[model samples]
Target: MNARLPERQASRALLIGSSRFSHEGLHDLPATVNNVQALADALTDPAMGGLDPSGCRVLTDPATPKQVGDAIDAVVNEALDTLVLYYAGHGVLSRHGELFLAVEITDPDPYRVHYSGVPMTWLRSALAESPADNRILILDCCFSGHAVEAMSGTASAVGGKLDIRGTYTLASAPAHETAVAPVGARFTAFTGELVKTLREGIPGCGPLLTLGDIYPALTRALVASALPRPQRLNTDLGDHVAMTRNPAYRPPSRSASKPRVVSQPHRSPTGPHRRASDEQDPKVAAEFHSAMLDVYRKAKKEAGYNAAYFLQMVQEVGGLEAARRLIRAGSVSSGFTALWEKGRLDLSVEAVVLQDRFAGLFTDEELDIARDRLAEYGYSSAQTS
Candidate 1:
């Protein structure tokens, strides 16, 4: 039998959904409860996140201010290594720009929000104070973007802003936009698409699904539904930090007996001589890089904004055989670059940190060329240093 890989860090989730409100003007949302249950189920699926059912809490109809605070404290005080907080309901914004998660008895009155709603600041404080190594916040409600604005930038204590370290925040809409819950649907637009992405999993993204892989798909799904576009605030973790395992991972077939080898025809003496080193021809590498840029531009324009689907689109743009040739030739920089742009930044300072990894896959000449091109986009050695 093959040895299994060790499990990921222990993680817990708290899902809250509010449907009813004290004010009659705010109609109850039928999809909110469904969102909580579906997400909870996915979190507990062995083929998915594999979280313990007892560690995942689902609070429907939204708990009061005190209950929400207590719940956060209890979860964060545990010995878990990671904590995820998800809220699906009506997100309210005060005149001064503070955000709140509306509870079952929350009053719609703009002036009385303090008395009825749970302030996002409270949750932020809890997360900032938590001992967990990683924290994730997913908000699927109107004006969820305010949460991102509330938590942006490096760790600091002033203004009650949460320390941005070790945290990833996914907001369903812009600060002023309304996150829609389609009537009769099983989940909210933001979460319904999220669930689908989680189930299908992303190709070329390995056995685990990180928030980095999920963001592009979720944004495209919401945009296609004509719902508010999702926003994300991410921290630079050196490598991909996974939130869950792909539901579709399967072990490779094993063989007990010795494997057989097949022999190929020997090259004729007159045939072209092949180099022993893995380094690729400079001209061929340059051509491959140029072709990749063209394909990336076309893919960006025609493949829509969903990066998850672009993997197949890329295969279609360049035939499978050509891709295989590039890989065999050790010209993997092009493909690595294409994959990185699928979800990560195009030309931000963050790209500088990833330059070494992407360039390492290239030959010396190709690496020089890549550095030159990246420098044109402000990714310079000085910046990274």
Candidate 2:
């Protein structure tokens, strides 16, 4: 075992979320993709007290395991202490009791396997190669047991013991159960609810927000949202599930400079924004915003993504009334929960304008989703807030 560990817990994270990938309808539902992305963002967030935000890397399938492995490779080599891995999407188990990632691959032979998912065993080995003191893994897929069972059951990554102290693992649901999520509302589904817990509701839970407290809260939320009742279970692979070993985590001192923390992401020019202010030109920012926009626009058609964007952008250009005509035009799309409260769920010219206004002044936290909505409307993500 590679017993030598980091002086403190420096971490590197890898996030993977598979979507409507398998031909056999693996990611057949919208929630499947949305949940994966949400979970990825949650896990990679440095604010979660998991890792250095800058060190997180995300990989998607169709993208090879080699490519995925390669990204994690860089972080591991950097000597980060904790390695946090999160996966969201579909998983498949074979009669032979093997677990696979079930990418956008299909088995043409029906009776014979044509494509094989990424084996979790392969991933555990990769983590073993890292010099980090601990590893925290989270998987949000169906049939996730064998892979984790394989990783945790085998001894020898942390210290001399295979089941090392301080190594933590959390799985969305237990093995063999078909986890359920909304057919299309991925973002607000079970996974989304969990993020909400961490983001908006944790403090409300009172006192210390331990993983023991947090994990089950999220699990209960997930099972509660399951339609027609879901087959669900949460697992604690090893004994040491140290909720979060936050090096700098502490209650803010009641001092003159102590600022009340708000749940919103918009907290002014904090990290990246401030950093970008120094070197990035407007054009570079535009490019970054635009690229992500394209992907969002493509997806907006199904959700109310585009309408909101169109309304907002129109206000940014012409005026509020001009945006209304578009909302009143024709048949509305589905999926998104009606969020605005301009009297009705329908995007009134006024709410559209307000939406646009909010987008203009979006808190950094709200910015990404706002950008995605803009993308639905074919707007650039880099629109200066």
RMSD of each: 11.0, 20.7
Superposition TM-score, candidate 2 onto the true structure: 0.50
Worst 10 residues of 2 by lDDT: 334-343
How accurate locally is residue 285 in candidate 1, as Cα lDDT from 0 to 100?
43
Clashing pairs in 1: none
Give the poorly placed runs of model 1, Cα more than 4 Å off.
Answer: 1-9, 153-158, 236-239, 248-385
Q: Residues 1-385, candidate 2, lDDT per residue (tens digit)?
A: 1112122236677777666454654545445455555655654555554444466666655444555556667766664566666677666665555556655563323233324466666566666666766666666666665454656564222123243334555565556665555544536244566567655534322232344434545644565656222121122222223333322234433551232344555644443221113123555334434433432354355333444443344435433223323232211111111222111222322222223323332233333333344344334434333
What TM-score, computed on C-alpha atoms, does each candidate reach? 0.66, 0.50
lDDT score, residue 28, model 2? 52
The lDDT for every candidate, in the order shown, is: 0.62, 0.45
Give Cα distance to truth, residue 214, candidate 2, Å.
2.0
